[model samples]
Target: MRATAEQLRALRQEVAGLERWQAETTPRRMPLGHAEADAALGGGLEVGRLHEVFAGHGADAASATGFAAMLAARLGGSLVWLRQEQVGREGGALHAPGLSEIGFDPARLVLGLLPDPLTVLAAAGEAARCPGVGVVLVELWRMPRPLDLTATRRLALAAETSGVSVLLLRVEAQAQASAAQTRWQVHSLASVPLEANAPGHPALSVELTRQRSGPPGGPWQMEWDRDRGIFRAWDGGGAALSGPQLPLAAHG
Candidate 1:
């Protein structure tokens, strides 16, 4: 027999309670599919935390942005990217077509061009609290003094409370103190050469500069495989160089 309204309500409550319990008990780290990188990242980058990526020079800004995009793609959800107007103008606006060529899905992206740091932070905080956003990326060419510990702490709390990942992209910024769970320094590396000496997958020389939970360690040479949507160790002289590189001139 079909259940009465009261019985159906009770069953719904039970299901909701079970889901909440599972979320609380399950491990939050989502693996990047690279064994070594995942191991160094404490089983993978943890969700609900603020992570920082620093670019040492103006040239490395592209590498940093690419790395952050790959991470957001790995998280497998819609992304919200916030950038101050000045940074956007200086670093070049994030081009959708260019980003898609690098493996980021343009359809899942939302861009916010704010006028100032405070506005950017405010937008990021609100976006982080939104359950629909999978990842929130905030770009800061220089971390303003106003974005002190309290501000970062607020960002961290928002991410944690909503179970979203936050990436802070700092271009040409000094490594100062912050409340980020982990900090990375990224630099562009020569991409693997494909058949006919073509440029292959994008590569980055990533160094783990800081970690709040464990000892930070890495100078890992990593590559992003757009086909597989995961990171892999840069194979120096092996199958990585044997195949033809994927073309970016066109896409489905």
Candidate 2:
């Protein structure tokens, strides 16, 4: 049956109200530890969304994993680390000295050593659906098939609906195009130098390769204190080490 103009107008208004309510009610924002990183991420990592971290090479994988773990710790939720490939054997362990310093409780961490990428993805989705689990980290360095839109969309939808923050850790060499909300490419620079007044090691040079929503250039020089087990920004004027300038690239 054809609807009259008045009825159609009323229906449209109802739909609009629903849309507005959803926008206002949906919670989207996870706290990334670093202020700069959070700002760069457009108000932290969006809660209930899939975030992809692509490390340009093998060396960057550990840093990416550590960084993701740190972020998870700050969000105050249970962390599920899904190990893909031989990530378990190949220094995929999240026990960075920096983590302890940064205040991440070892007890709250849950580790899953899944060699199969598909299995890992499936489990991550399931964990996200579970109300108790807060964050799920899927390490996909050695997945057989490249991540494409289909897989990413599935994860993204799961995150959105379940209100879980998902981090996809991929090797830069292995990563292909994906439909993730945030595709971050990470590159490690040199470590930050130890300060004269302080009695510890310096920070590391972490370059932001790509950010989907925010400005990209950052030799975002950061420092990880071994003794303290935390990361801090390097103050360049002191004896701290400084990495090369990271120029932002045009959005892909």
Candidate 3:
């Protein structure tokens, strides 16, 4: 059926209006601004959901922790970090100066130490219920038997209801069933230096092993910008100074 010009114009206007409404009403996503990665993630990482970051091996634990920290920093409002005592003892505490180097302000960070996994989860659940907090990060050295499906579900529900992003960081842990909206496996890779013989921002070898809304993605090479505190898609080289940089808002 052939439509008149006026009919076609009306249809286009309607579609545009619908899109605008969706953008305003639906929860916003935080994009890395790398075209390919953003497209794979259906625009960006979904807010108000549970995300799991797992270290592929013991050596990758630091990389995973840094990755999770960057995510929390990106979210921007009051941040809470709950760490299991054993994990803190083994991995050491998050350094204030180091966090600043990665673009995270140490002043906005709140730290909590818990003796056991159950207590850590309880704290995370409570933090996730706070609408004022932009993100809550929980570090568990290993997932114990007590952290079963029900426990994860409770965390997920709290995040969704409160519209707070929750990051579950499992260090030196293996893959297992989870109720998280997305799961990422991280490993450290060689970073590209800015000048001859000088160190550069760290690189991460990341793979999306599971996602509730999209096909598993990546094994993408991504690099961090210490100054900007954001990740960019990398192909093993130094970032060009003259280019359109990814937009980093005060709040993601």
Please list the residue runs of candidate 3 whose C-alpha ends up more than 4 Å from where it truly belongs after superposition. 1-25, 237-252
TM accuracy, model 2: 0.71
Worst lDDT 10-window in candidate 3: 237-246
Candidates in order have lDDT scores of 0.84, 0.66, 0.82
What is candidate 2's local distance difference test score?
0.66
For model 2, where is the 10-residue window of minimal lDDT? 193-202
TM-score: model 3 vs. ground truth: 0.82
Best model number under lDDT: 1
TM-score of each: 0.82, 0.71, 0.82
Give the per-residue lDDT of model 3 (tens digit) for 1-252: 599999989877865865575467676799865566678889888888899999989889999998998888877787899987777567887788988888888898898889888898999999999999889998888658667777888788778777889999988777777789899999998776555535567788889889988999888888887677578877654554333355689986
Between prediction 1 and prediction 2, the one with superior TM-score is: 1
Q: lDDT by residue for model 1 over 91-138, one digit each (tens)?
A: 787899987987888999999999888899999999988878899999
Candidate rank order under TM-score = 1, 3, 2
